[model samples]
Target chain A: MSITSLPETDRSVPLNRNRRSALIALAGLLVAEVVLGSIWKILPQNSAVSPNVFTALMFLMVPPILFFIYDAIWGIKSRNSKMASYPMMLIALGVFVLGTLWTVMFSFTNIKIIPLFTPADWVKGFVGLANYKRLFNTSRWMDCPGLTKAFQSGWEFKCAGALPNMVTYAVLSIAISVSLGFLLAVMMDQKIRAEGVFRTIFLYPFALSFVVTGHVWAWIMSPEYGLQHSIRALGWESFSFDWIANRDMVMYAIVIAGIWQGTGFVMALMLAGLRGIDDEIWKAAKVDGIPAWRTYIQIVLPMMKPVLVTTFVIVSSGAVRIYDLVVATTDGGPGISSDVPTRYIYQNFSANLGQSLSASTVMLVAMAVVLIPWIRVEFGKKSQA
Target chain B: MANTSTISAEPSGAKPKPFITWERAVVYTVLIVCALFFLLPLYIMIITSLKSISEIQGGNIFVPSSNPSLAAWEKAWNSACTGLYCEGIKVGFWNSIKITVPSTIVSIAVASISGYSLANWPFKFSEGFFTILLLGSFIPYVVMLYPIVIITRYLGIFSTLPAVVLVHTIFGLPIQTLLFRNYFASLPQELFKAARVDGASYWQIFFRVFVPMSVPIFTVSVILQVTGIWNDFLFGVIYAGPTNYPMTVQLNNIVNSAQGGKAYNVDMAATILTGLVPLTIYFISGKYFVRGIAAGAVKG
Candidate 1:
C-alpha cells in the first residue's frame, strides 16, 4: 500500500492492520498444518506415510509461523512497522527453517517426517565419510565402460587418489574459467577497433545455458564428426586430437568450453573498470612520454586491481559449482575423466541414492575450502575500510 | 622519460598524435586475432546448425559447401526426443517464461523494498540484516540446493512452478538487494529528506521519488535477473518438474543423451535456438548497458 504519505496519527492504523493480517495468516497456516497432521494420523499407516504428505504440510506451514514470531518480536520493538511487520518475512524464514528441520528429521527417522521431506533411507545408511571413502578408494572407477571407452585401449588409467574426477573437474574448471576470464578482460580493455562487436561475441556464449554451449562444444570436439576429423581431411596425416576421449585431456577440453562461456563475464567486468579509469591519468601518462605498454603494466593494471579481484571472485564462485556443463557435455565421462564436485553430488542425490550424504559432505568441504578465504577477504575489506 | 616530458611541455607545439596510433598496430592486430579466435566457435555452431547431418559428417567445418538445411531446425523446434517424449524444446518454452517472469518481477519488487528500506530508513538492524544477506550471497548455491530442495519438498511445492520461481527469487535476492541498495545509497540523501519533509510516506517516497529515478538501475537488474533465471538449467530441472522443464533442460536431453551417436547438427541448432531469448535481450538492451553501469551500482 501507499507508505509515503501516512499521516503521523494514521500510521498506527496500517501498522496495526498489517499486524492483524499477519496474525491471521499465521493462524491460518497453523490450522492447515494441524488439519493435515490429523488427516495423516487417521490414514492407514502404510498409506499415510507413503507420500510423506504430513511432513510436507508441516514443512510448508511452519515457515510462516516462525516468520510471524520473528515479525511480532520485531514489530513490538519498532512499534511503527508497516508491511515489514506482515507475514511475508515470517513465511520466507519459516519455510527455510522448517525445510531444514524436516530434511534432517527425515534422514534419521525412517517414518515419513513430512510430505515435503523425501525419504532419505538410502542416504542415512552411510554416515559421515564412509561413502566418500568408498568413492575415492575404488579402483573400479577405471573399469567403468564410459571411462574405458573414452580412453581407448592403449591408455593407462590412473587411480583416483583422494578426490574423485568430479571434484577435480570443479577445481580445474574454476581455475581456468577465472584466470582466462581475467586475461580476456585485460585484453578487452585495450583501445581497439570493433571492440563492441568483440565484446558481444565474447559475451554471446554466456547467454546460452551450459546445456547449449556444452553440447555444441561436445560435438565440435567429437572424434568422428567434429572439427578434429575435418582438420584430418585437410591431409594433415598425423593429426589426431581426441581430447574429449583422453582421460588426461578431458578436463582441459571442459576448461576450454568453460573459458569460452566465462571470458565474456570477465571482459564485461574489466571493461567496466577500464571505462571508470580517470582520463586525467592517461593524459598525464601521455604527457610524460610513458610507453603505452608500460602505462598499462605499471599504472592501469594496478588501478583495475579491484575490478580484477571482483571478476576473479565471481568467476571462481561459478567455476567451483560446475555441474550443468559437465553433465551436458560429457555426462561425467569419457569415463569419469571430467567429473566435477557438483555433478558428483547430483549423481549421488539422484541416481546413487545410497551415497547422497557422502557426496554432500564432499561438496560441503570443497565449497568451504574455496568460500572461507573469500568470506574472510570480504569481511576483512569491509572492516579495514 | 625525456621524450615524454618534451611532449607534455609542447602541448601547444604539435599535439603528439593519438597515443594509440599505427605504431601500436600490434595491439589492434592482437585484438583482431583474439576476436577471430573468440568468434570461431560461434561460426562453427551456426554453420553446423545450417548443414545437413550427412554434410556435417562429410568434411571441413570451416567450409560452408555442405548443403544448407533447415532439417535440424525443424527437428529442434518440433520433434527432438527427450526420453519418451518426442516434442522439442518448445514444450518447455512457456514453462520457462512462466517461471522467469514471476521470479524476475517478485525478486525485483522485494529487492526494491528491501533496498529502499536499507537506503532511506534508519532502522537499527538494517545494516546487520544487509550484512547477513550479503554473506548469504557467498554461500555456494550448490550447498544450499540440497537444503532448499528438501525445504521445498517439505513445503509441498518442490516440483512445481511456484517452487522453481520461489527458488529463483530466493537465489536472486542477495544480488538484487545489493544492486538496488547500492544504487539507492548512491542517490543524494537530500532528495529523500526533502520528500519526507513534503509529507511523503515510505511507499509514496519509494514509488514517486525513488523508483522513477531508478530506471537505469532497474534496466541493469532486469538484464541480470532475466539472463540468470532464463538460462538456468539445474533449478529449472529440479524444481520446475518434468511437466515444466525449461528449454535448457530439453536442450540438454536432446544434445547430451548417452543413448546413441552425437547429433551435431541438431545439437548446435537447439543450442542456438535456446539461447535466442537472452541473446535478443542483450542485443535490444545494448544501449542500456553502459548507462546501467554508469549509474554506479557496481562502483566500489
Candidate 2:
C-alpha cells in the first residue's frame, strides 16, 4: 500500500536477477529487430508487400521494446508484494495494444479496410517518401511558372506552399497570443475591482468550442455585412476592413480570431502564475523604489519561468492543431491562402490518401519537435527535484 | 499596499488626496476597453439572434433591437435545416449527450484506474510507456483519423457513437491518466501503506482509499472531460455518421452550408446554441474550470 509500510527485509531484496534477465531479453529483441529490419531494407526496390509490412510492424514495436529495456533498469516495485508485477505487465500490454500500436501502424501505412472481406488492399506497398514528396511538392516547384518572379520578389504569403503557410500561421499566432495574454495578465494582476467579472469575460471564449468562435469571427470579419459595414454606416463612407477577403492578409485575419479565442485561456494561466508570486516581492520592490513595470520585467517575470513554459506549450500546441477555427472562418478560401496543415489533410485525405498521409506524417514530425523537448524538460526536472 | 484605496489614494503623508487621478482613469479605461473587446462577439451574437432578419440586414449592430424576438432561437433549435434535415441542432443534441456522457464516463474510469495503477504499482518500464503515451498525445488527431476510421470499420463500430466514444477514450487517455496519476501520487504514502498492511488488494485500495479521498481532482477531471467530449467536432463529424452527428458538427453544417439564402439570425442562434453547454459548464463550475485548466497545464 505504501512505501514506508514495506517490510524491511522484503524491501532490501535485490532485483539483480530480474534486472539481468530483462536486460538480456531486451538486448536480444533489439538485435533481432535491427537485423531483420536491415535484411528487409536490402530487398529489391520493387519487392512485394510482405517485407514492407514486416518493417512497418517492426517499427511499431520499437517503442514498446525500448520501454522493456527501460523497465529492465528500473525494477518493478509494489507495496510489500511481488504479485503486483503480473497485473502491471498485463495492463501495460493492454495499453500497448489499445493506444500505441494502432497509431504507429496508421502513421506509417495507407490501409483501406473497405470491401470487408478482401485482404488484398489491406497492406499497400511501401511508397516511402513518395507521399511526403507530394505534400511538399518537392519536384513541382522546378516547373512553377512564376518561380523566378517569386524568387525575385521574396517569399510572399503562401509563396512556398501550404506547409510554409502553416508554419508561419503557427509562429505568428503563438507569438501574438502569448504576448497579448501576458500583457492582459499583468493588467489583471493590478488587483483591480471586479476582477472576477473581468476574468470570466476573458475566459468565456475559451470555454466555447472553436466552431462557435470561428463562425462568430467569420461574421465579424466579413467585409460586406460585418464590422466594416456597420462602421461604414456610421458615416465613415471610405472605411474598409477586408482582410478576410484579401488573400495576402487573410492569415492575419485568422490569427486575430485565434488570438481572441485563445488569449483568454492564456490570461487565466498567466493570472494564476501571477497570483502564485509572493506578495513580499512587490513590497520589497516598492521599498527599493523600483518601478512596477521594472519589478514585473526584471524581478517577477523571471521568477515565473515554469508558468511561462507551460503557457507557451499550451498556446503553441493549440496553434499546431488549429483546424476548427480555420474551417469555420475561412475554410481555406480566397484560393487557399489561409489553408493550414490540418485543413489540408482533411480536404485531401479521401481524394489524395497518400499525400494526406504524408502531410500527417509531416505533422507528426512537427509535433515531435514541439512536444519532445517539453516532455524532457518537464519530466527531467521532476526526477531531479 | 492596502493604504492606497482606489488608484486615486495619494501616498500617505504626501499632499492632498484627489478624488480621481490620471492613473485611475487609465486603469479603468484599459480594463473596460479589454472587457468590451472580449464581450463584443457575444453582444453581436445575442443582438443578431434576437433581431429580425431585416433588422439585422439594416445594420445597426450595436443598437438594441426595437422588437427583440426568439424566432431565430426557436428556428435554430427546432426547425433550421442541417444538411438534408430541416430539424435543427435539436436532432444532434441527444446525439451529443449520448456521445459525451458515455465517453466521459468510460474515459475517466479508465484514466482513474490506470492512474492508480501507475502511481501505486510502479512496474518495470512504466515510465517508458508513460512517456510514449504522453508523446502520443501530441500527435495531431488528423494523423490518426483515417487509421481510426479503418480500425473502427474493421471492428464494425464505424459510424456509431461507440466509435466516437472509443476514439475519444483512446485520444483522451494520456491527459486523463496523467491527471489521475498525479492526483493519486500526491496522496500520503502512509495511507497506502496502512491499506496494504491491512490486506487491501489493489482494486480494494483504489476503490476504498483512493477514490473517496480524490473527489476534488475527480470533479476537475469531470468538468474537463465533459466539456472536451461535448465540444469535440472532428471525431463527431467523421466517426458519427449523418444520423448521429453531434451538435457542433450539425451546427457547423447548418450555419456554414452553402445552400439557401444566408439566414444570419438563424446562424447566430445556432452558434449560440452549440456554445451554450460549455458556457454553462464554465459559469457553473466557476473556479473548478480554472483549476482544471491550471491542473491540465502545469506538471508537478
Candidate 3:
C-alpha cells in the first residue's frame, strides 16, 4: 500500500523518514550506475574488462540491496511490495544490455576464435579499421555479378560473399513480400466465403520456424525427387526446375521460400491495417461515385502508411536476420552464394572473432538506420497526439 | 481485411450478394490458387513424411503414397541420425519442451512484473529504463551474440540448457514487457485507485483484480512467446550447443547433415515433428495468434 494509504498513526514521521532515505539511497545507486556506464564507454577499446570491478560495484550496492530486500519483506507483511520489481528492471538493464554494448566495443578489436574481452588477452588487440578493410576487400564479401559489388572493380570482386547476397535477399524479399501480402490482403478483404479457412491456410507457414520452412522448401525445390521429378513423371519428361541447386538461381529459391513464409504475416498485418480504416472513408468514396478499385488504390492505400511502415520494418528485419532459413535450406552452399549478413556473422563467429564482430557491427548500423526513421514516425506521432 | 465492400456503396446488411460476377469468380480463383500455394508445402511435408523410401523414390511428389506407413515417422522419432547420433529427434523434442516451458514461464513472469511496475509505479527513471528495453527489443540478436556467449561462458552456463533459457528470457523481455505494460497502462486507473483506497498492496491488487481482468492480454502474451520461443533456431544452435540442441536445430542437422545417403522421408518426418508444436498452437489459438501478431507488430 502507498504511504498515503497508511493510517495516520501507522504512517509516522519515522516511516516517512525511512521512505525518504530509501528513495535517496536509490537515487545514489542510479547515479553510481550512470558513472559506471560512462566509465565503461571510455575504457580503451582493447583493454580487458575485469569481472572484479563488477564485483566491487555489486559490493557497493549491498546496503541498498539489503534495505530493499528488507523493505520488500516488510512489504509482504503489510502489503507494500511495489519495489519487488525494481531489481528485476535493473537486471533487465544489466542482462539485456551488457552483451550488446560489449559486442559493439569488441567490434574494433582483432580477436580470433577466442574472445579478447578478458584481462589476460588484452594485449595489442585494437585495430581500428583493419577488420572492416579486410571485410570489404575480401572478394567473397565484395563480389556479386549484377548488384552493388558488380559495379566495383572486377578484378577485386571475385567471390560473391555474404554481403552482396544479403543485400539481394533483403531487397528482393522485402519488395516481394510486401506487394504479395498487400495483394492477398486485398483479395481476402473481399469477404469471400470460408474466410477463416482461407486466412488459416494463408498464415500457417508463419507459425513454423525458419528451419522448418527452409527444409520443406528445400525438398520442394530439390531437383532429383522433388517438383522436377513430379512434373516429368506427369509425362512432361522435360522439367528442369533446379533453382535450389543452381548458384545463379539458388538465392531466388531462397527468396521464394522467404516470401512464402513471411508474406502471410505481411498480409495479416495489411489486413489489420485495412480493417482499421474508418468505414466512413469507404462510404465517403462511394458517395462520391468512385469505383471500388480506385477507392482502394487512391484512398485506402495512402491511409495505410502506418501499417505499411510497420510491415516494412517487420519484413525487412526478418529478411536481414535470415540465417536459419539459409542454414536449414542451402547451408549457404555453392560457395556461400545464398549467404545473408546474419548468417555470415554467425559462421565467422566460430572462425574469426574480429570478422564476425565487424559484420555484426555493420548489421547493427543497418538496424539503426532502419529503426530510427520508424521510431520517429511511430513514437513521434504518439507523443504529438 | 480491406472492407472494400465499397463496390456496391450499400451500407451493412442491405448490400446484396452479386450474382456470379467475373470479379467475384476471379477473387475466389486467386484465393483458391493462393491457398494451394500456401498449403502445398505443408501438404507435401505430411505426404512425404508418411511415404516410405521406395514410394518417395518412385516419383510424383504431389501424389500421396499408396502404401503409407509409420516407418518413416517411427524412424524419425526413434532412429533418425544427425551425424553420429541416431537417437532420432525425440531428444530434441523433449529438449525443446524443456526450453520452451521454462523460458515462456520465466520470461513472462519477469517481464510482466517489471511491466506492471513500469505501468503503475511511475518511478523517476521508468521511461529511461523502458527506452533501454525498447531499444533492446530492436537490436538484432546477431549483434548481441558474441557478448552473450561471453557472458554465458562467464556464468559457466554456456552450451547448457539454463544458458539457452537465460538467453531466451533476456531477448523475450523487451517485447513481453512492452505487451504487458501497454496492456496494464490501458486499464482504467479507477480500479487501481479503488484498491489503493482499500489499502491493498501491489501484489494483492495485481492478483485479486488485475489478474482476473487480464485474461486476453495474458493469452496474447503466451501465444506470442510460445510461438516465438518454439521457433527459435539461433539460440538453440548456439547456447543449447550440441548436447542440448532443440528440435529446430536438430531438424536442421538431420536434414542438412552430410553423412550417409540422404533420408528424405525421415528428414521430412522430423521437419513435420519439429513444426507440429507451433502449428498446433497456431490452429488452436487462432484469434489470439492474430491479435498477438498485430500487437507485436505495433509494439514500439
Candidate 4:
C-alpha cells in the first residue's frame, strides 16, 4: 500500500467551533450517564423514554467511543474529510476480520448442526482436532477412496472428501490451463489473421458460468447421447468419452471443462504480457540468430515471470474454489468420486457444522498459501518504488 | 495493435511472406482448429436448442438441424419445470435482474467512495485495512459462507433476494475497491490537493473531480459485477432460497433434474437463455474485460 506515498502533512487546523462544542457536550453527557445510576429512570416509568439495552448501548457507547476516535486521532482542524471512510473500514474489518476469525474459532468446537456459544455449550462442545481427524479418515472425507483399491468391484466409493481431490483439481487445472494458454498465446503472437475474432472466441466460454459450461460439456461428454453417440452414429463404433461416469476419470472431465472456460482468460492475460514486452528483445534475438521458439523459451518466458506467476496463482485459487462446476456437472457423482473441498463444506454445512467449519478453515489456509507470496511481490514492489 | 517483430532468420525489412508457406499452413491449421474447439459448445447449444428432442436423441450432434424451430425456447421460457413449479426459467431471470441491479449500484457506489478514500486520504493504518481487503479477495466463500448466513439470519433477511444482494456487495467490495483505488492513486495528486485546498468536501470532490474522471473504471467495474453477479450460482442457491433462485441455479435444476424422460432440447434452450446475458456482455466489452484484469493483476 503506498504508505510512504501519502501527501505532505499540512499544518493542523483547529476543529470547527460548533462541532467541537457539540463533541464536548456529548462527551460530558456520556460521562454523566456513566456516573449516574440510571438516566433512564429520570423519566416517568411509563413516559416516552423507553430505555432498552440497544438505546442505552447507542447512548453510553457509540457517542463516547466515536468521540474518543475523533478527539484522539482524527478530530483535527486540518483534515475534515478523512473520517468519511471510517465506516467502510469498519465494515471491511467486520467481514474480513471478524467473519474469518469467527469461522476459525468455531471450527474447533463440536458445532454439529448450528453454533451454540453459551458457557455450558462451550464446556460440552469443545472438541479439538476431532473435526480435522474426520476430514481425512472418516466416511465422506477419506482421501479419494475410489483409487484406494478397496472399491475395485461394482462398489461406489465414499467420497473421503476434500483432501487430495482439491489438491488434484488445483494442480491439474493450473498446469493444463496455463500451458495450454501459453501455447495459445505464442500462437496468437504470430501476427495471425482474425486475431480479435479468435481472441473473442477463446474467451466467450469464460463469460458463461460453470453451471452452463458443466451442463453443456456434460451433454458433450456423456456416452448416452453426446459425443460418444454422435461419433458412433457417424460410424466410429469404438469411440467412447464416458469420463463423467467413470470415477477416476471424472476429475479430468471437470478439468477439461475448467480448462476450456479458464484457458481463454489466461491466454488473454499472457497475450497482454506478450504485448508489453519490448520489441527490442526480439530484434536482439534475431541478431543472435536464435530460433523464434528458443527466444521465446529462454527470453520471453523469463521476462514474463511475474505475469506467469500471477496467472498460475489465479488459476490455482479459482480451481480450489471449485463448487458450482462440480455441482452442475456431476454433483459429486458417479458415486461421490469427484468431491471437492468447497462442495464438501457446503454439503455438510447443516448436517455437520464442525466438519464444514474445519474444512473451511483448511480452505482458508489453502487460500493463504496461494496468495501470500503474490501479495508480497505485488505490494512489496510498490512500496519500494 | 499488432506488433510485427522481425524474426531471427528473416530479412530485416518488412516483406510480404508467401501465403502458403509450411509454417503459415501449420499456424492456420492450429488456430482454426482451436477456434472450432472454442466455438463447438456455442454451436452445439444453438443447434441443439433449435432441434427437436427426437432429432437430438437419434441424430448426430454435429449436423445442423434440418427442421429448426423455437418450440424448445418457447417452452423453456414459458413452461419449463423446476420442481413442481413449472412457471419456467423467466422467474429466475427477473429475480436475477432484481438482485443484480441493486447489488451492482450499491457495490459500485460504496466501493468507489472507499477507493477514493484509500487512494486520496491515507489515514493511519488505512493501508492495513486496504491490504486486508485486497487479501480478502482471495478468501474462499466457504470460510465466509456460514458466517454470512448467520449474519443474514440475524438481520432477519435470510433466504431472500436481499441477502444475496448484501453478499454480492460484500464479496464485490475487494476487487471493485481495488479497481477504483488503483485508478484514483494513478491520477495526478495535484488535482486532489487542489480540491482540498479549495475547501471541497468529500462528496463535492468525488462527484465533481473523481467521478467525472473515472468513467472507464466505472464501466469496467460494472461489466465485471454485472457478469459476475449474473453468472453467480453459489450465493443465489444458498442465500436466495428457492423462490429467488437466479437463472444459473434454475438452469442447472432444469437440466439436471430428471422427472420425465430427459428433454435435451429444452435443457439446451434454457442453457442458452441463461448464458445469453453474459455472452452478450463478453462480446460488447471484451476489451475492457482483459483491460480490467491487467489493471487488477497481482502487480498492483
Clashing pairs in 3: A140-A161, A189-B1
Model 3 spans > 4 angstroms off: A1-82, A85-88, A118-124, A144-159, A382-385, B1-15
After superposition, candidate 2 runs with Cα above 4 Å error: A1-124, A138-161, A382-385, B1-21
Q: In order, what DockQ does each candidate have?
A: 0.27, 0.31, 0.48, 0.43
True contacts kept of each: 0.30, 0.38, 0.59, 0.52
Docking class of 3: acceptable
Residue-level lDDT of model 1, residues B1-300, one tens digit each, is: 011112223335344667576745765676667677678877888888888767777767888744688888888888887777888778877778888899999888887787676655635545655665554555555555666776666556778888888888887876777677666776887787778678776778888988999997898889888888988988987888999999889888777563576677777888888888987888887645433432222353
Cα RMSD of all models vs. native, in order, equals 7.8, 9.4, 7.6, 5.6
TM-score for candidate 4, please give it.
0.88
Clashing pairs in 2: A1-B192, A1-B193, A2-B193, A71-B125
| Candidate 1 ranges with C-alpha deviation above 4 Å | A1-187, A283-290, A350-354, B1-23, B257-261, B287-297
Q: For residues A29-82, what per-residue lDDT tens digits would candidate 2 score against the true structure? A: 788788877786777876633464556557656765765666676754352222
Q: What is the docking quality class of candidate 4?
A: acceptable
Q: Runs in model 4 with CA error above 4 Å?
A: A1-74, A77-82, A117-124, A144-160, A379-385, B1-16
Candidate 2 at A53: error in angstroms? 23
Using TM-score, give the best candidate's number. 4
Worst 10-residue lDDT window, candidate 4 chain B:
B1-10
**Best of the candidates, DockQ:** 3
User: B1-300, model 4: which lDDT tens digit per residue?
Assistant: 112233322344466777588887888888889889989989998999999989988899889799999999999998999887888899989989999999999899889888887777666677788778877777898898898888777656789878898899999988888788878877887787788779876679889999999998999899999999999999999999998999999998888775878898899999999999989988888777767765666324
Ranking by lDDT: 4, 3, 2, 1
Cα distance off (Å), candidate 4, residue A211:
0.8
What is the per-residue lDDT of model 4 for residues A1-385, given as tens digits with 9 covering 90 to 100? 2212334444233354345644665676567666544665575767533355324344545644565556545544424334556546755787788888888888878898867745577668788888898776765665555667665776665444456667777888898889989988899888777777888899889889999999888888888888889999888888888999998789889888898899998988888788778889999998999999999999999998778877877777788788899998899898888888888888888898898899899888988888876776566676676
Choose 1 or 4, whichever is better by DockQ: 4
